[model samples]
Structure formats: C-alpha cells, structure tokens
Target: MHIKKYFGRMLLLSFLTLPFIQGCAFFDNYARIWVASGQYGTDVKDLIAHWQDYNISYAGLSIENPSALLFDTKIDGRSITYEKWVPVTDENVLMTIVKWL
Candidate 1:
C-alpha cells in the first residue's frame, strides 16, 4: 500500500513538472509572439501584419464571440473555429479556450 502511494505521488510530481519543462521550450519558440483577446474584426489583419514584421508567428487570437468567417479557413495546425493557432507558445491555448474558468 505504501509503495503504491509513493508511485502515485511520483506520477503526480512528474505531471506537474512537465509543464515547466515544456514552457521553457514554448517560450523559446514563440516568446516573440504576442497574445491578444478582443472582438473579431478588421483588427485581426492588423495583428497579423504586426507579427509578420517581426517574423513572429501568430500564436492565438481569442475573440469574444467568433463568427463563421473566422473558421471558414484554417490558419494553423488547427482550424480557426476550433481556436487552434499554429506556432503557439504551446498547447496552453487549448486550456485557455476550453475552460475559460
């Protein structure tokens, strides 16, 4: 019983540390990218242009209420409707959209 408890604790610790390790790599890849949240409009174009200037990829954009036009096409690995942006800092964006908790 004690051995099982130790194993579980170790697993939990590893899970917790995984994010920190991944975060480092994420920041390295997309530290230049910025996060923006607001209404979906012409602003998206402006943001994209800004990032392009820096050669930084668009990580993610969170709008208050997305529209069909947003997801009509895929911008990154995941569809825009799904709120999945490419070259993200990491999968952290998933957590941000799903829970919004």
Candidate 2:
C-alpha cells in the first residue's frame, strides 16, 4: 500500500511538470521577427511607419528575399523560417539582428 501511494504521488508530480517542460520547448521553436528592410536600407523606416499607419501588430519584420528586397516566413510546429535583408548601411548586419532581439 505504501509503495502504491508513493508511485501515485510521483505520477502526479510528473504530470504537473509536464506542461511547464513543454512550454519551454514550445517557445524555443517560435521565431521572432526583428526588422524588415529594403535595398540600400531604403524603405525600412517607411515600412515600419506603414505598419503603424495601418495599425498592424507586429514584433518585427522579416525579409523573404534579401536579393529581391522581399520578405518571406513560415511557421510550422516548433520551427520558424524567417528571411530578411541585411541593411547595407549597417557594417555588421548580424550584430544588428542580434541587437534587435
């Protein structure tokens, strides 16, 4: 009887912690957009302003084809594929991206 009770308690604790553990993994797979940009860093500020003008709720922007100055992204399960251009004005685009986060 004591063994049975202990097992029951252990099972309950595991179930209670399951959601928390899953949540960590869930957020890990989510991708956050930092910013969007156009050629020569043009239209960035305007784009942001446009979103605001339209009352869009967005964390950041993602460019689809940096070469073409387009933005594309995909969200599936616990993975995100976001593409964006690196502003030419910024010397270190990678660092800038990290800073946006």
Candidate 3:
C-alpha cells in the first residue's frame, strides 16, 4: 500500500518536473540550433540568428520575422521596412533572406 502511494507520487513528479527542465532558458540556446536545423536547414548554426529563436541576421542586420516572405528587419536595432520590395531594394534584408533560404 505504501509502495503504491510512493510510486504514484514519483510518477506525477517526474511528469511535472521534466518540462520545467526542458523549459529552462539555459537549455534554449543549446536547443535552438537543433530546432533551427529543421526549420531553416542544417547551416543554421553558421547564420546569425536571434538567440531567442530563428530570426536571422548578417553583418549587423536582422529580420523581424524569418517565417514571413514579406517582413520587416532591423539594422543596429533600428527597424527597416519597404513598401512592396524588401529584398529588391534592401541589400541587408536581401542577404539575410538569401542566407535563411
């Protein structure tokens, strides 16, 4: 009876605890590269993507949303956008997307 109770408690704790270990920001850095490989390809480790997730960068420019075909970007932390031509006119955004693709 006591063994059953302890085993139940242990099972519950293990389920609850594993996610917290996985969710830790410390693991995100190590995990992000692996996740990016599937989303952006194996070369993702060589690209300058945001540490928080997969927004890529080059030189000093970064895309706001790499998941979007038409999205904004930043240079030295300042936002950069175009009317209908981001990669057409913006060299940084162009290069960023090229690398991402």
Candidate 4:
C-alpha cells in the first residue's frame, strides 16, 4: 500500500511538471532575458525588442562584475547556436552585442 501511494504521488508530480518541462526551452530564454536585463541595467522590453534582430536572442548572464553576455545566433545554415562574450561591463555591453550581431 505504501509503495502504491508513493507511485501515485510520483505520477501526479510528473503530470504536474510535464508542461513546464516541455516548455523549458521557451522559458529558459525568457529567464536569460530577465537576468541579462537586470545585469545590464536595461529594460526587459528593450532587450526583447531586439530579440529578433539578426536572429539573436538573449542566452545567459553571469553573476559577476565582468559578466559574460550569452546570445544565440544562427551560423552557416545551422540551428541557433549559443555564443559567448568576452567579459564586459554595462557601458559597452550593447555595443559589443551589436558588433557581434
């Protein structure tokens, strides 16, 4: 009986989390955008405004002074690929990203 109850709970948990797990890719991008916006003192709307520019998207952000600006870009007919930035500050972040794009 205990084993059956545990299995039932596990199944319920799986069902509850399935949607989030399935949409993780989309959510992850939003999360990265949020993080990047906060780190670079930019607005989420502003960052998202440029999301479709050159097929570039916010990828990730580091939690340090010299943060790594992660972005997704298409290359050579390939799927979107993650690219890294050499450490930069808020002042030059946009310029660097624009240059990269």
Candidate 5:
C-alpha cells in the first residue's frame, strides 16, 4: 500500500543521512579547522582561527553584531563550558563553505 511505500522511502532516507551525521561527529576537528580557515573570514574567521591556534575548541558559537560584534561561545573540552562574552567587529562573514576542506 502507499503507507508501506512511504515508510520504505523514509527508512531509506534515514539510512542515507545517518552516515553524514555520524561522519560529522567522527570528524569534529575538521569542522573547527574549516571554520577557522582565514580564507573564509577576513575578520571573524581570524578570531575563530585565534581560538583554534590555541587548541581551544568550542562546542557552540554565537555571534551578535547588528552593527558591530558580540561573540558568545562555549568551550568544548573535558567538560563543556561557557566562555566569557567577547565584543568586537571584523565585518565577519564566511565567504562560502562549499569548498571548505
């Protein structure tokens, strides 16, 4: 029936996506490196690079810059921790993530 066909399609889709989800976790550091690449950000990426250069991995990154810069991030370490608020501006923008290694 249509219900069975729909269920099969959903199951197939789940299987296809599961690998990408798992791959991201297995290659978490790659994500950081990609984000920190100076080629991507003339300013904001530099800030991220600074953190990476120090081997400081953050679990989450929050940026608020209506007209300037306000960065809020959580460190990813033995224990996830929130870092102090950072305020600044760099005209931050990730050019394109498509070619990111």
Candidate 6:
C-alpha cells in the first residue's frame, strides 16, 4: 500500500514538472495570445500575421463568432481548441481585438 502511494506521488510530480523540464509551448503560446489580445494593446491581426514567429499555426477563424481566432494547437499530445477572442467588422475583418479584460 505504501509503495502504491509513493508511486502515485512520483507520477503526479513527474507530470507537474514535465512542462518545466521540456519548455511548455502551451503556456508560451497562451502568453502571446494574452499579450496580443490586449495585454499590451497589440493588434490581433498582427498576432495572426506573426503566428509563425511563435511556431504556432493559424488554423482558421470561427464562422459563428467571427471574432474567434482558432489555432492548430495541442498540448500533452492531445487535441484542444485553442481559441482566442477578438473583435471583428461586419465584413468579417478583425476590428481591434482588444478588450479590457
């Protein structure tokens, strides 16, 4: 029983530390999104234009929302919807993408 507990703890610790050891790209990508989303007043279109700078790909934009920016991203080798919100014009163009949140 004690051995099982120890193994479980080790497993949890490993998972927690794995990102730090391997340079987690998810957090880095999120940070860029945060910044581009108006953390520093950067435009979202600029973010899309420079996705390659962060090694992230722009999968596409959302049709329903029109302001949602989608990315071809995954974390821990699993698929996830990495969506970022921004403003859009009536013609489907990005407005400002800066919201005070």
TM-score of each: 0.27, 0.30, 0.26, 0.26, 0.27, 0.25
Off-target runs (Cα >4 Å) in candidate 6 are: 27-101
lDDT of 6 by residue, 1-101 (tens): 99999999999999999988877676655545333344546555665565443323222354433333443323346544454533232322322222211
| 6 Cα displacement, candidate 1 (Å) | 0.1
The segments of candidate 2 whose C-alpha lies over 4 angstroms from its true place after superposition are 26-101
- Residue 77 lDDT (model 1): 47
Number of the top-ranking candidate, with TM-score as the measure: 2
Ranking by TM-score: 2, 5, 1, 4, 3, 6
What is residue 8's positional error in candidate 4, in angstroms?
Answer: 0.1
**Candidate 5 — number of clashing residue pairs?**
0
Error of 4 at 82 (Å): 16
lDDT of 6: 0.47
Look at candidate 3 and tell me the lDDT of residue 54: 30
| lDDT assessment of candidate 5 | 0.44
Against the hidden true structure, what lDDT does model 4 obtain? 0.51
Write candidate 2's Cα lDDT for 9-87 as tens digits.
9999999999998875678647764445565253455544333222121224542222333222122224223344233
Error of 3 at 87 (Å): 38
Better of 2 and 3 by TM-score: 2
